[model samples]
Target: MTFQVARMNEQESAAWLGLVTVCQLLPAALDSQLKQDSGMTHFEFSVLSVLRFAPDHTLRMTALAETTSSTLPRLSHVCSRLEKRGLTDRFPCPEDGRATNVRLTPEGRNALVRAMPGHIDTARRLVVDALTPEQLDALAQVTAVIRGQLDDGRPARGNPFA
Candidate 1:
């Protein structure tokens, strides 16, 4: 028996390289912007955004981890930082005494609110405005297809990586 590797064609290689580059650079760029403007990382901003939309601005720790695509330890560390900054609080989950829940505090909400303008501007400058309307639509569809492939049975959302 022989093992063979199928190499990507020119177009496929370009696409793959572009995707990899975007994956590598985009987060760092966004993280840098968020840290400069809001004193938070992109992941932290994501956590606050998730909690802000959650019921009563709260979510069980596990749920938060899933929603944010984080491990429990990472979530716990980020939560601790957020808690220290008065952005969020962790406490016993009311429905389950054994589990914990994190709540977005008023300070957290305000911080998110304050962070939005600069974040949106950065997003526009880096991505949104860089594409035409057609390109944006195409990008969304292409990304959804890629995410669907990567996530398997998981639900889809707007550029979870971003």
Candidate 2:
């Protein structure tokens, strides 16, 4: 069989590389800030924050995983850790016995509240403050377009920008 490989043009390559670089570096930076300030990883902070805003401070495991862009297994593991720390609780959903539900404890809410200031500051230092308002808007638009393309028509829940 014969095949041809398509290569990106210089402009496409530059854009792709820039995106890759940001994806690689941003997570570590956010994790570092969260770990130092709150004794939690960035993903853990996200889970708590999402739960804090959820109705009744609870969400189904599947819904939480979708909102956080995490796999169910990974979210389950994180939830387990949070449960052990007394920050969250997971139990079988009453309305749907087949589904699991997770809730942020009051302590989890407090922890998230404490984490937010430092997290926001770090975000501003690393990203928000680095962009002009116009650039920020463009970035949001660009990411939204990409997210729509990748999300398989699944509506996003509780997206702050949305």
Q: Which stretches of candidate 2 lie over 4 Å from their true place?
A: 160-162
Q: Candidate 1, which segments miss by more than 4 Å at Cα?
A: 157-162
lDDT (0 to 1) per candidate: 0.91, 0.90
Q: Candidate 1's residue-wise lDDT over 109-135, tens digit each?
A: 999999988888999999999999999
lDDT of 2 at 43: 91
lDDT of 2 by residue, 77-133 (tens): 999999999999999999999999999999998998898899999989999999999
